[model samples]
Target: MATPQIHIVKVQKIYRTANREVHALQDIDLEIYAGEFVTFLGPSGCGKSTLLNAIGGFSLPTSGTLTVDGKAVTKPGPDRGMVFQEYALFPWMTVAQNIEFGMEIQDKPKDFIKTKAEELLTKLQLKDFRDRFPKELSGGMRQRVAIARVLALDPPIMLMDEPFGALDALTRRTLQDELIRIWSEFKKTICFVTHGIEESIYLSDRVVVMTYRPGTVKAIVPIDLPRPRHTTSPEFNELKNILGTMVMEEQSRHQKAELAGTTAD
Candidate 1:
């Protein structure tokens, strides 16, 4: 087998407040390979985002190690690009400008940035909106631009934190198809976090289901379904039911914890 591109070992993260410590992640050990698509799925507060952040080097693990291509991830770097649900684009910049922003920051040659920006604009079907600003576009268009901006950097690994969670169902499914196309064409290693069971099963080579608070891997379910999956198919529904049960259990645990905390207070 090929060596893993990302190796995480016994990773843990703790967030402290004045009165208490919140353990966000605990003993997470996994390996992700190059050009693979993996989804982190679980209930709210399960540290799915935390784990994705750790891999992107947005946050440090309190214990254990995270490495990409044999190098420890210490901080955010060009090797990994992150896409958030909020569509973190500059409102002041045009679609073209937003796509070129990263390359411009790196002082990439103007010609190269222009060429790359144009390439992504066309690839993402944003050529028509290149002159528009973020506020002028619809939510779906804004997200497409956000994705184009990230692709401009050509990072080998993309970290997405529920990037489609806020969109309408139709738009979400459309973007999911777009993402799959990009992944297949670009050969990127993507780590995605989402609360949608169908989304997880539809997009991932494997779905990593996390437990509730103090989150750790509850199960790593490989999605063996073929591409262009039908959500209503028997096999798809079977997998969805299984994942739904796992996530529902964790959510129940989270609800119980909340009640206990409230009682104690």
Candidate 2:
């Protein structure tokens, strides 16, 4: 069997404030197989983003270990590419320039950077917008540029944190299809975080349900539906219902916890 692309073992994250400590993650243990797509599905503040950050080496866990491709992750590197909820494109740069930013920072050869940037622009269907600025493009088009920027690095693993959360329904759906197509064609390992149950089920090979804050894994639900899944299909709806129920239960439990805390205070 192929090695796992990303691995987490009993990871925990804690934050220190002036008056108190915050537990963002607790005992997160996950394994993302190489070339497979996985998603962390949970409500807001569930530490899904925290876990992704840990794997990307942008944040360190208070305890436990994170490994990618059998190497310990201690800092951010080009091997793992990240796309945030907002398009972090440079407004001053053209689309092609934004995509080449990483390469430039790494002092990569100009020929290689140009070739890779052009290739990604073509692959992501953004060749026509290569010279356009973020302000000149639609939200979906800007997101495509954001994704292509990360893809230009050719990371073995891609970490996406609600990259489509800002778009409208129709635009989000279009980007979803585009993402799946890119994933299928590139076969890169992806760990996507989202609050959308249907989106998780549609995009992931396995949907990992997480608990409320101080989060831990609630369940890892495997999606057996075939590619190009139709949301209206019975099988798809069934899976959706299952995931929706899990999320609802977690949310309810979290509300109860919050109420108890309030009453005690």
Candidate 3:
């Protein structure tokens, strides 16, 4: 329906080296609708991040196609903004300057950039830290600035690669709530990659479970729970159990593969 905002068909990514070839992703066909929040969930080496990177145009697939709004995704564009596990802020710049960096590069007008930066500072709860540098702020505040920098461009799709994974649990939860608020207000399609089962359940409209290396879509589980989901709720735990089982199966496969590779070596 509505010509899915991001349409991926048979996407596969392979990394070739002098000694070996690694198939990072395989047969990844997914259709993400506009304004929907989706998470790619699986174990390490499952290619979830690889898939996200392909969608973000940080890397290209070896075969198949990924398109946004019916056009091929050959490179990164302003339509998509990416946040990483590492707070990728300019260490030398103040919070406000970091937020304004992208717009400045785009040659946005001085007044517009200033106004937008101020709005983001207030909206992301970073008003007091506006003049602080990255090192001066806490992990959570740094991420907020990173997010603000992305939002300054006002991308329609947000690609977040475990943006909260490095923070403390309490901080992670706080950022999750903030992200949900932002998504609700902006109505942006979000493609997030994470290893946290509960985090995926809490954030996504659908959880895409992936297989181990040479990743394939094992199952796409729709999260039907209402918003502001509670982790302890019976419904939440039930879905968590299902997803946890699927992820465990893949992780076992990954471990077996690793052992076999070691033995062969």
TM-score of each: 0.97, 0.94, 0.97
lDDT of each: 0.93, 0.90, 0.93
Residues 103-167, model 3: lDDT tens digits? 99999999999999999999999999999899998899999998999999999999999999989
Count clashes in each candidate, considering only residues at least 3 apart in sequence or on different chains.
0, 0, 0
lDDT of 2 by residue, 1-265 (tens): 6667788999999887767777779999888898899999998767899899998899988999889988999998888899889888899999999999998988999999989998999888899988988999988899999999888888888999999999999999999999999898888999999999999998999999999877899999999989899999999999989999999988887788777772111
Per-residue lDDT for 1-265 in model 1, tens only? 9989999999999988777888899999999999999999998889999999999998999999999999999999778999989999999999999999999898999999989998999999999999999999988899999899889999999999999988999999999999999999999999999999999999999999999988899999999999999999999999999999999999998889888873111
**Error at 212, model 2, angstroms:** 0.3
How far residue 32's Cα lies from its native spot in candidate 1, in Å, is 0.4
Stretches of model 1 off by over 4 angstroms after superposition: 262-265
Indicate the residue-level lDDT of 47 in model 1: 96
